[model samples]
Target: MILHTTEVTPLSGYRLLLRFNNGAAGEVDLSNELDGEVFEPLRDPVLFATASQHPVMRTAAWSNGADLAPEFLLDLMRVQQGDRAA
Candidate 1:
């Protein structure tokens, strides 16, 4: 089954609350995830907190044009919850 993000809310300091369509939710700290050129703009607090879910994409994206893949987010959640992906 393909996973899609239902919603994303900015928490603090590169952390975000993510809700998935599969009823799984997690708080993800993106501090370590942010890297390279595409994520440079997100270093700004205001931009980091601008996480929004794209209706069409159904993924979280920021005003700086940075976005996180659903697969990556799901894996992170799985690890955080101490559950390995099957």
Candidate 2:
């Protein structure tokens, strides 16, 4: 099944609370993932708080055009939740 982000809420320390279309919801910390040119800008708390669910992509995105795939986010969420199989 293809996963798609249905909602996203930015939290402190570069974390995000996400809800997927499949009924899975959790918080994923992205503090360590902010690297490279595209993700660099999100290092700033202000910009990071701009995270929202993209209309078309159906994934987390920021005004700077930076976005993460839903599948990636779901995997990270699972890992953070201690689902080693993720």
Candidate 3:
């Protein structure tokens, strides 16, 4: 099944509250994932707060053109929630 992000709210400590098309929602911390150029800009709190659901991609995106796949986000969320099967 294809998963699409429905909403995204940025939180402190580089975390995000995300809702998916499958009716799953959770907070995922991305503090350790901001490494490469695309994600590095998100280290800035202001930019990180710019996270939102991309109109076309239907996934979390920032003004810097950085976007994460909904599937990846869901997997991350599951992992954070201790769902090892993810």
**Over 4 Å off, model 1:** 84-86
Q: For each of the candidates, give the backbone clash count.
A: 0, 0, 0
> In candidate 2, what are the lDDT values of residues 3-85, reduced to their tens digit?
89989999999999999988889899999899999999999999999999999889999999999999899898898898632
**TM-scores across all candidates?**
0.88, 0.93, 0.93
Q: What TM-score does model 3 achieve against the real structure?
A: 0.93
- In candidate 3, where is summed lDDT lowest over 10 consecutive residues? 77-86
What Cα-based lDDT does every candidate model obtain?
A: 0.83, 0.91, 0.90
Question: Which pairs of residues collide in candidate 3?
Answer: none
RMSD in Å for all candidates: 2.4, 2.1, 2.1
Evaluated against the true structure, the overall lDDT of model 1 is 0.83
Ranking by lDDT: 2, 3, 1
**Model 3 segments more than 4 A misplaced:** 84-86
The deviation in Å at residue 1 for candidate 3 is 4.1
lDDT, candidate 1, at 56: 79
Candidate 2 RMSD to the correct structure:
2.1
Q: Which scores higher on lDDT, 1 or 2?
A: 2
Q: Give one digit per residue, the lDDT tens place, for model 1 in 3-72.
A: 8898899988788888888888878778887889998778788988889997878888988777888888
Candidate 1 is scored at a TM of: 0.88
- Give one digit per residue, the lDDT tens place, for model 3 in 9-64: 99999999999888888899999889998999999999999999999989999999
